[model samples]
Target: MPAAVAELSPDAPAVLLAPLLAQFAAVARLEHVTRAAVELGMPQPTLSRAVARLEQELGVALLAREGRTVRLTRAGRIFLAAVERGLSELERGAEAARAEADPTGGRVAFGFLHTMGSEAVPMLLRGFRADHPGVRFQLVQDYTDSMLQRLREGELDLCLVSPRPDGPELTARRLGEQRLRLVVPVDHRLAGRQRVRLREVAEDAFVTLEPGYGLRRITDALCAEAGFTPRISFEGEESETLRGLVAAGLGVAVLPPATVARPDVAELQLSSPGARREIALTWVTGRPLTPPAEAFRAYVLSVRGQLPLHS
Candidate 1:
């Protein structure tokens, strides 16, 4: 360790030297203790003592007197260079922090399920931006569990999730529920039906989102309620991919209503009572959001029953 770090008292962390560093830098820049003191709005004697204290803390001689003026010694020049860079970085950090707090122009770290990316999320974002165009969003598309984990880790400010996650750690608002459909290849026998019972497909091979996804869990539960375990033939991370697999007749899938029409598959309504997944806006229960995040949350809730659930 350098002499300065070695000499510091346990309670006097290097952070405590911040003000003294500023004082020292001003003095070093002016090369005249009295004049630097005047520019710094402090008495010359107080400035002199602060500079001395800084030197003592650093265990180095930083200045030399010439007549009534002062000059930085070689050590002072080197230390000043480092201090100036550190101060500049700290200033930049402060500016970024302030910018994040700006209500109209700040950034919001928003997360949502991949299922919503096709339409619902984009629609919400477009409507929110219509009124607050300057606000920026950092969007994360993820599974419900992963998104909630990021929310807890401070990586996400808000999320639109399904199955309405619950716990002491989360705050969730029910936005509205969207109907889940049973999608089948167009040539399949049941594809001609406007609606079908969940149990009707009990023997059909299933294509689904992979395990750990909220929709997957819902699919499994609905299948169990329908009195059979789905024999999943293919699993994927995205709902669109599953839809495509269904189109290829790989297997049928349970999915949210499609935003765009796909002539290759037919979407049928479920006769099951709970074939719907609830959508919610979620965040860490006790965590305070930045201004932009809070604004976006309020805007989302304001639209409550108005989310574009279908294309």
Candidate 2:
């Protein structure tokens, strides 16, 4: 253990010293010296003295007395902001160090688009837990654009996306492609057709995904290529809700086979210029993969063939 400095002086910034800044940050964050000390697993008096020393060195009162609570002074608020920033930088540095040391068993944050999460996420999680149980997995469901942005900002360790953007900074591997099918109620007239064409159903009332979703983009582009614009009767975010709408005879929709394979609907392949969605796993180039993330990626690819509708 390193020797503790007795005091911070005018020449030295308290934020530059870890122990002093940590003590101050804890007290500032918790606003109670006893609670902060308990959380930090240090003696309350020792933590309180450290905070007092930091306040003396900074030449400002950092805490204000309330009836039964301690609050940050205005000066303390400003100093705490700087301390938070410093702590964030330190956290990243520590993450980088952990990445260097283990290259696995560290925290991994991942994001997946809504459609993929329907089935793929469960498979990935199961396999990941089986293989690397120690690693923590933080998974979030987001749109493609948002997920990609999170990956770029280092907020996510990996993302599963579709129609991957062409770029040098991103690395991607094709998981598989899924054929699009028109989902309709079993009692609907279109359900009896051996196969459907986009043009035939071009004008049908439809419950489709919102504009920016990968499925919606594919559906719109395919309809345009087929020489007609789809008449969208309703727009929704979840594939399950869209399927439910179709089952209720509200409207028809084009979706990946897996989505329509649910019990309430019948899926039909489109004959002309068949629509397909390409799924891929993406991550930042040159960044190390944490154990859970790597396991999840491998599991997705491994189970791709077994998925009900994946091609």
Candidate 3:
């Protein structure tokens, strides 16, 4: 470390050094102590005292006085470079914080389950934007556990998740529920049924979302309630992909209702052990939200009952 930097106490508060650094920068810029004081709107003696205190703290003379003018020592110029860089970074951080808090033009980081992205999320965003057109969003689509991890890490401001996760670190508000469907290839033995008990498919091989996904957990719980574990044949990341795998006659799957009908597959409603996933708006408990994020959260709650969910 440089002699000046080495002299700075590690425990010293930055608040105490910021103003002194600002004063020194002005003096270095103008190369005149009294005139710098005038520019900073302070009495000349007070500025001189502040500069002296800074030099004492650093154990180095930063400026050499010549009558009314001043010149930076070799050490002074080096320190000035570091000070300017730090100040620039601080200014950028301040600007970003201000922008985040702007009521009319702020940003919100939002996350949701991939299953909702096809229709539900788009409809929600369109509705929210119609009322607060200036608000911007950063969207993330992932499985429930992954989105909740990001939410806890402060990477996400709000999330739309399902199965209503519970934790002391999180706050979840139930918005609505989506009915789960049993999807099978059109030519499969049970495809002709409009409703079937989950236990009826217990012996059938199932293609489902990968573990850790909210839907997969719900599928497991519902199957357990119906008195059997589903026979696993394949696992997938996306709900639509699982549906496509079903269409190929790979296996059956429990999934959200399809947004559009596919001639290759049949969707049956569950008649037993109610196959419904409750959707919730979730956030980190006690974490303060920026203006835009709070506004978006409020708007979502207001229209909770109107959220689009396909049958």
Candidate 4:
């Protein structure tokens, strides 16, 4: 072992160096024992001993004494950079802990697909906020896969997604299922029908979301099962945009039943083997949720019946 690292015994517990690290950080910043100690609200000798102990623990001399002012050794500069980041992270963690402990109000980072934002999410949040008026929410709107990625990265506490994400790293609870309807221009021939089979649309052009959205995947699967690849006329990000295109006689689209009804468009039931998308609340397994997040999850589960869906 290097002499600097060897100064501290190999058997010494790693946690014991925390205070010395703080002390060294202070001294390294001031480059003067008396000033660092004054800033730390400690005696000069005490601060001096702390730095000496840190050097001994690391088995290296962290500082070079030049009569009065001390300068950091090469190893000391490298160690200081790491310590700054680590200590900053620790300080952030402490602030988060305090925020989570606030009994009056807390923040929840909630995520959901763009499709649900129009009606479903607004309804859910409205009811939740009535009871938890003090609680604040940060809304993240994205497609299914992107939302799941954010959940795993700890950016989102939980997400409202469709088709129920499947992976060992994620845990999902089905809230309810939203039946997809076939939308067509009001004057289109199929608009007069109450229901139609997927194969009936084989000859029609379709408007759909771009690839990567769960709805698009469902659209592709249904078209494949219907024995024909859809003739896609338009690709978009929002369901409302797809609706507008369908209303303008651009092409037909498959959208959730709760989608906004336009005078120029007609929504007909589309029959398929699995004609519905499952809406679920998904979170990363083994990651702990904040108290407010946990409470909101329980509340949402209890009120699944009130959500927009077929009973």
Candidate 5:
């Protein structure tokens, strides 16, 4: 161990040096023994002994006494600058931690897919804020893979994701189920039908999410189960946009019940091998959540049955 670490009292860990370093800063700023002692609210004799101990612990001469005053040694100037920055950063970190832990006004960094932001997330947050009006949220709208990456990197406190979390590091709770419907342009042959099998639309061109999105994976899986790969005619980031493509007669799409509202398009329930996607609330295992986020997660799990779904 270095001399400074070795000199720490056996019972007092090195964390104690942070405050002692602040004392050295107080004395160095004043440069007068009596004045620094007064500013520190300590007796001159006690402050003097503390400085001597500091120098001994570091194996360096930090101060030069000239009769009644003191001046910093060359090494002391460099050390003082570093100490001030360190102490200032520690203070900021403490303040941030306290703010994040506050029961009523803490912050939560929340993430979810674009599919949820329009109705689901807004409704969730509105209810959450009714109970905690002062809590702040940082919302991140992303696909599953991107959201999962941000969650692991500590950028998000929790995520509402789909196709249930798979990694060993993830902890997931199934929130509820959403039934997907086949959407087609009003003039298409399948539009008037209230229900159809997935295989019935096999030859139709499809509009889907980009491959990286979770919904796209679900779409591919449903297609595979239906015995054919879709010939994707259009791919976009938003479900509403895909619905628009269907409305324009560009292609048919499989979409969640909530996002398929357009006069020009019709939503039909699947008959055989019913199509649906499972929604889940996911977080990192063993990672702690900010107080506000934990509250939101608990609130969501408690009220999941009330989540909007097709009747």
Candidate 6:
């Protein structure tokens, strides 16, 4: 909280504008006054006072205190929803202003999952940079959930993610689907098959991604649907490690076609209904897309035809 926010009263006219609304939204998001204060780089007390003043002006208690934790009241929940819409609109306005000032030269931050980091990302960036050289790109690599959260908080302009939750605040466009293949050691009996059924591989030892990773969940679901539980051999995060384990004859693994792009591993198509994962580009709905983000999205769609899909 700062001295200025602390001094604000319910009757102040400035409380009705965008800045106060942004502060209220941040406080609502963090819940803790201190954490919200830290995010805003203001004194906690000042942030608390600003929220207090906003609540006063609205004639509603925005938050309910339970011990040290704060939860939103009904009015607060409603207010927060409105604040999200308002803030999104404000962001769009700012973006529009920036575009008016300079249509092409602006900074944009993008985040993507590790799975898409190698070829897809590079291709998209290269095509975008070729078209809009003046637009600066800031790339971030992170897991799916963290990337989505950052996008919601306005820290990222765009993100590439798998199918997940959707709401009025966010929009998604399909990039394309990637086939999930079975990777086995070269000397393994299954390696000679053109395509192996899931049931055939059900009893085989498996190395897979750790829980919370997108591919892990997909593999688990596919195995379950095939009426067999995978024989767990090793759990890890990186797909490269999983592939290496398979190549070393430790166990078999399920991965996207792109995962086996290297020549070291053998990729076999899975039968009994092969599995595929959808990839998409997502951003906050109604938020104005920066030139860089728009260009990247366009390039991804343009190149999507080249992506492999299950027959």
| lDDT (Cα atoms) of all candidates against the true structure | 0.88, 0.79, 0.87, 0.85, 0.84, 0.78
- Stretches off by above 4 angstroms in model 6 are 1-96, 164-168, 258-264, 306-311
> What does candidate 6's lDDT look like per residue over 111-155, in tens digits?
877777777777777777787788777899876677888899888
**Better lDDT candidate (3, 4):** 3
TM-score of each: 0.69, 0.69, 0.70, 0.71, 0.69, 0.67
Badly placed stretches (over 4 Å) of model 4 are 1-96
Model 6 clashes, total count? 5
The residue-by-residue lDDT of candidate 1 on 190-227, one tens digit each, is 99999999899989999998878899999999999989
Clashing pairs in 3: none
- RMSD each, Å: 11.8, 6.3, 11.4, 8.2, 10.3, 8.0
Clashes of each: 0, 0, 0, 7, 0, 5
Q: After superposing candidate 2, which stretches have Cα over 4 Å from the reference?
A: 1-90, 99-104, 259-263, 291-309
RMSD of 1: 11.8
lDDT of 2 by residue, 42-138 (tens): 9988987898888877799999967545899999899889888778767866776776567557777888878777677777776667867777778
**Candidate 4 lDDT, tens digit per residue, 1-311?**
32344455656645668777888899899888888999999999998998888888888998999877899999999989988877875764664677677745788899988877877789888888888888899999988888898788677889999889888999999998888889889999888999999899889999999888999999999989889999999999988889999988899998887454578899888878577899999998976677778878888898988887552
Ten-residue region with minimum lDDT total, candidate 2: 9-18
The Cα error of candidate 5 at residue 67, in Å, is 44
Greater lDDT among 4 and 6 belongs to: 4
Candidate 3 lDDT by residue in tens digits, 97-145: 7977677777789999887888778888999899889988999999999
The total number of steric clashes, by the backbone 3 Å criterion, in model 4 comes to 7
Candidate 1 lDDT for residue 15: 58
